[model samples]
Target: MTPEGTGRALVVGGGYAGLVTARVLADRFDEVTVLEQDHVTAAPEHRRGTPQSRHPHALLARGADLLEGLFPGLRAELREAGAPVSDFGQFPMLYPAGWSPRVRTGLALQTFSRPLLEAAIRRRVLAHPRVRLLDRTRAERVVLNDARDRVIGVRTTGDALRPADLVVVTTGRNSRLPAGLSTAGLPAPDVLRVDGKLSYTSRVYRRDTASPPDWQASLQATLAPTARRGGTVVALEDDRWLVCLFGADGQSAPTDPAGFAAYADSLANPHIKDVVTRAEPLGSIYRYGGLGGQWRRYDRIRPWPGGLAVLGDALCVLNPLYGHGMTVAVQQAVLLARELDAHGPADACARFQRRSARTLLLPWYLSTSLDLGWRPEGASVQALLARRYLARLLRRIPDDPELYRRFLAVQHMTASPLTLLVPSARGPSARARRGGERS
Candidate 1:
């Protein structure tokens, strides 16, 4: 098939990553088509395409900023829809040591269910004049040129072909891109995986606005080696609270009502349990497992084809426990946009792939290091040392507000992790030294 200049772009999934990609491609391509297998709906409801959507999700400070920049007034629209936007620093947290101090740190976190956020982005992206959504259509494999040096388009189910100048795959964690590449006579990217055997059981509860909790959201993080249980209670739209209880290693949360409540009560902190005990259940408990980190080293592939790029979970899937998946996906989308704008479609795919791999390094390290702690066999020397340092830092956070603030900044991706290496101004020794110097 012959192609026009800067012609069509195909996105082989309509999830969050795919939507963002379609939006970005719309700016450069004459036509952008998103082929999704699920029958997407207008309402903020869960679909079969994303089973994890039923669980609680967090949009980190960095992700919120990027999404707002991409879709102006998105935060306001979510706020109007009753999604709570609050300073992330003020959210109460129970760490390995004790309760984290609630202080303002200028970091904003917008809380909502995954489905709601996806629906919001989907509406905005599909509304673009250049973007089109082809729901209930599955992209069987990417069509390649005879030379196998370039991707020509995608072959959908029923042997139908959709021609495009570029084909971006965002099929997510369970992507079939590897198989598709193999079928197209190309080498599949090597997979790197670290499984922590993490599991989540979540349920929504009716929030009583008249007697609101002191904190809008709360977290009790799991500390490996001793504590395998953790949970979170975040305020969501329509006066609802999404409570998710999780366990690491061999532990798994029960889906039964009584068992779920018992799991929450077993946590080291009482915050989530207290809320779960009193709140009225709004829905059935949903459970998700097989959670861990996986990375497809697409950048390392030799003879990488032009006009093909993998973004988001298709390239790397970080354990959701750290809440880095959405943020990293947004970062990848931003990187893709920059590459296309700088180099144009003809030569941007390979460069974008390599850069995207570099972008995943930090988040992959942060996620796997903690997960490795759950399985001693998989823990390398570097992972062990990181866990030790993180444990010490968590122990100090409760007593040092400045330290907690800095940690919060790092968690939100607003500050560098190196900042944590500095001594806290509020630490007792630091204060004493400062006093002596002043005297």
Candidate 2:
């Protein structure tokens, strides 16, 4: 059936990215339908399609801001639902530069399980009159026109044909968009991958102590080359802590309780070890691995289908350690809405894809650069130099609160990456700046 004013827009996948896409589409299109392979649950539990949701997920400051803009009262609603709020500086983060300088940076971080966040967004999107969420319905391929120049709709697993004027694929890392394009007699996009061999083991614990800890959250990232183990302890709703132990380059976090604790103990930060051993256990350890960063260069496809666009992981799957994946997806959704409004439907798909490539460049570079360091075969010279520079910057963060705040700004997606490269207290003197000369 043709929609009210604009034609129907079909979204493949019902994850956070897909939900956000659908939510945006509802404003531009007459109707938006979301197709998911697994059942979408209202409970704060992982769906079959989202195994990694079991781990602690960080919603960056920019992500929270954009989400609140899209869904008003979202921050208050989430807080009411038990998602805790904390300032970014409240977290005692141990980077290669020792512990992060704890100071109120004024940036807020919304900490919660992935399932809760996804469910919340799903409810809002599905509640829209123009949006219909079809869970347990898997999209098999994108149907193309007779000339194979544009997408007409999608073909589902149940022999169902969903015809639409626009199609956005947010199916994520396991997306079959490339295969579907190939099946439709189109050239598949090239894939760029960095195999970090990353693995993580997570478990929930009950924080029953009457006295609260000094820190709200703790993150310890393994320094490359010398260290390959890291861990994070994030406070969750209902007085719980979600602790994750991770490793890269063959140092895998074990699923066994004893092994998990041992791995946490190996981390440079003693806080992670203390929380893991002291907190009362709530759930069995869940092991997740084989998460290598991969990006489909769909933007490079010449004569791209006019009505087809890919978002989120389907386009660029970053290493989750950076905690920017969700933020990037929401940003893309906002970009899509703006592109559609400005360009209209005629060229929105192609324009959005091209613009998305630009949007992901910084986050992609930042994430992959770190993942490149996990290579036992040694990183590229450029990556090595970049890492060294970052290490130097990290060393001075403790002594300089302003520098830490700036760095946190970038990490939280509120500042540009160039901010971190600026001269810190250890750099040139005030006199040197006046003379425009190097130290």
**What is candidate 1's TM-score against the reference?**
0.94
Q: In model 2, which range of ten residues has the least summed lDDT? A: 430-439
lDDT of 2 at 55: 84
Model 2 C-alpha lDDT per residue in residues 1-439, reported as the tens digit of each score: 1124488899999999999999889987888999999986777778878888888788788988899999998888878987777888877777664566657988997788888788788888888999998889999989999998888899999777899988999998989889988988889999988777788889999986498777678887765656688888888877889999878887888899998888887776776888887889998999888778888988898888888889998898888888889999999999988878777665788888888998788787776776676662566787667666766666676567678889889888899988887766743222321211110
Candidate 1 lDDT, tens digit per residue, 1-439? 1222268899999999999888888888889999999999989989898999988788888888998889999999999999988888778777766677667889887888888888999999989888999999999989889999998989998999899888999998999989989998999999989888888889999999997766788888887777788989899999999999988886888999999999998876566887789889998999999888999999999888988999888889898988888888888888988888888766889999999988787778877877777776856788788877887787788778899888878877888899999886674433332211211
Candidate 1 has which clashing residue pairs, if any?
Answer: none
Q: After superposition, how far is residue 318 of candidate 1 from its true place, in Å?
A: 0.8
Instruction: Report residue 145 deviation for candidate 1 (angstroms).
Output: 1.1
**366: Cα error in model 2, Å:** 1.0
Candidate 2: segments with Cα more than 4 A from true spot:
1-5, 376-384, 426-439
Residue 40 lDDT (model 1): 90
